[model samples]
Target: MENYLNALLTDVMLKEEEIGDICDKACEILLNEPNMVNVPSPVLICGDIHGQYYDLLTIFKINGTPKSRKYIFLGDYVDRGANGLECFCLLLVYKIMYPSNIFLIRGNHESKDLTKIYGFYDEVAKKYGNSRVWRYCCDVFECLINACLVNGRIFCVHGGLSPSLLDIDEINRIYRLNKLPDNHFVNDLMWSDPDELNPGFSKNSRGAGYTFGSEVTKKFLEINNLTMLVRSHQLAFTGYQMHFKEKCAVTVWSAPNYCYRCGNLASVLRVDENDITGKNFLIFKDTPQKPSSVGLPGYFL
Candidate 1:
């Protein structure tokens, strides 16, 4: 029995190693690929895929391939939507296929605890007969993702600024373990949401965590010296929503038919920063095959 267990463990380790090898080779190819991240490149920033595999595929069809342009996925690649496993697998394949053009970040749903509750764990177990594939794919996710980045002038994260994160690199230092432990700040970073800008803590409507106000966002931005906070969390009927009017923060929601029937349009943001003085955005909207029966909220459109 001991030998058998040892062999099984060794097999898992070897499979993990092979996955890493494929990803590394892909990253190398991306590095050699010419002008992948050059200026004027239209950077495609997508919000929560939530395992909506067909919609994700449709996005690829509309936007062309990630190889042709820069792609930044703001996490939550799994859960709620059917095909969570497929969505994750396809992303891993893409990460290997176009390592240079794609940049993935960690999302709240990516955690094991969240997946277990939100359908991804069950989906994988149902499809694969166990958690092996889910485990494997998640390992790939943590290693391949960058938590947050100070991209020129904007600070990008899966969620928005946490009152705790004073420096951007503090986010980078968040080590990715196979599974998240309870009460960790990084866990909070992944799971927290900023719905309304209140100075005090309010219960998160989504049942995730506390709601943050403009004061937190303001202080966070002021301390970090960031001109804008670009994040993906909370659903927006129009796919992108701006807040504070004065502060340059924006939330880009990409999943359409979100939560199965939120009736929101799928969206993405394309920023052309080549001319620094005159930066502009090209917002892409996905009008689904079936028009949403409900109307968008006032703030979203």
Candidate 2:
């Protein structure tokens, strides 16, 4: 797999410029992530796959195989996991091989600084002896950052909607053609957190990342006319949990033994929606196993 990955990585690196609209490429990956959803189709939503390669394999084994059921991976595809490149390759392969069925969204880790701080940068360096794979992935990551609209009532993102994004179309208009600047609105959209936001309304916490309050979510929904927000970022003691259960918002944490020692069960959401308006949930329990890699010192944490 290493040799194959090396070769594939080389090819991608060479063609990076030719890909045209890399951000569009990312959105293409996102929109199609839920392709398995036929008319009146069900969408299987997975969360925070933080580089747990084997656990992802286990997910395929336990859940319906990607060949059968449609899947929507809710970002955070790299970092924390031992084989960030491998996990990424698998996703890209799925997108290329099963273009219609598999999908990927940009997670917080997809950023340059985060990847350099976490395992991905080091993992690539160790595997390829250079920054080739890392560079290529950065290109791909920028493209898949955000995905949305699950069951018309629900708005899906790797994290929550930011208070700054007043209009949903404003988000849609953020085309892939523009060079995404650091600390720009697009960057905040993918990396922001909802946990540390003030209860009423406020900018995200600097240390806690971009936190959003229930009111922000509520207002966003009302303005956009959405019924729910389905996101993943925080680790729940249970595999999954509902926030403001009455408001139709839910969080699914799918990384088992999250952060390597947290004991929280990993989870995924099965939207039992027959159509856009319908929304329901089925939580998947974590498959017992230790993470392949933890916060290894000097390399990643």
Candidate 3:
């Protein structure tokens, strides 16, 4: 498996069977985890890989290996970029290799509907000439953890909170058996965004989930006895965006130069303790082009 991972690390494509096996193994590890995974501090929190395999590698290169530092990915691993397949596979391999050290939660793009419309579905079909690989990955997506708690002080999710949510236990109670994870409560957890100006919940322009306000974040943290809420579902051209009063929530985007043309920076958050109020942002720009094998098919570009 290490050899295969090493090959993949260098842009070597895996056989279709190898990809299937990876998805299967990732699912096995993910199933045992609760919807709200608990993690220790002194870890790195990343957000919105959105494919961009080369940039993914650059982030890893800068952050060091998962063998030493723990990581929490806020999802959106696929879609909109050139190498969603490779990005997804590499992440699954990491999860399989170090189940406890690396944490992952599902984003809105993990849904079947979104993938079918986005580039991931097409990337799988283009590579394998079938949807089998996509299906395999979708199953693994279903098994991803939905939220994370860092030493009980930081709440990590792919998106903002659902108005109905009062605590992490509520997220765990959600039934985990959906290709889209569109159930009302979970939908907000995966698609909602935080608005610093708004005082409460409002209809999100994204057509799903609400735009949560500072008060909402404040109240949620107060109710949960948490000090910070870390999430990622939007672009922060400077790499990261902070929100809410008391600097309680932050959005960390790891996809530098998003879509290979946004000219935006990216970042990952480093938490050194349970408090998580420490502002440690590791910012970076995009890297060079991907291997021709995983480069855009022109249309996606």
Output the number of the lDDT-best candidate.
3
Of 1 and 3, the candidate ahead on lDDT is 3
TM-score of 3: 0.94
Inter-residue clash pairs, candidate 2: 26-143, 33-103, 51-81, 76-107, 106-144, 106-145, 193-210, 254-267
lDDT measured at residue 256 in model 2 versus the true structure, 0 to 100: 80
By TM-score, is 1 or 3 better?
3
Question: What is the alpha-carbon lDDT of model 2 when measured against the actual structure?
Answer: 0.63
Global lDDT of each model?
A: 0.61, 0.63, 0.86
Per-residue C-alpha lDDT of model 2 across residues 150-230, encoded as one tens digit per residue: 655566777766656767667665664467665565666565666433654455655423676676677778887877777
Model 3 lDDT per residue over 1-301, tens place? 6966886887666877898899988998999998988898889999999888888888789988677779999999999997888888888888888888898899999978899998889888877778998999989888988999998788998988888787668778866874344447788899999988888999899999989988888888898888888999999999998886578889999999999899999998998875458368999999997554563344533
In the range 1-301, model 1's lDDT, one tens digit per residue, is 2332233223222233444444455445433432112223347778888977667777777876666767777889888876665566556556666666777777877776788899888866665456776676655555545343434556667766554557766654554534545445565555666655476456566665456667777777778665666678778777777776454667777788786677777677776644221123334444343222112223332
Better structure of 1 and 2 per lDDT: 2
| Candidate 1 global TM-score | 0.74
Which candidate's TM-score is highest?
Answer: 3
> What does the lDDT read for residue 111 in candidate 1?
71
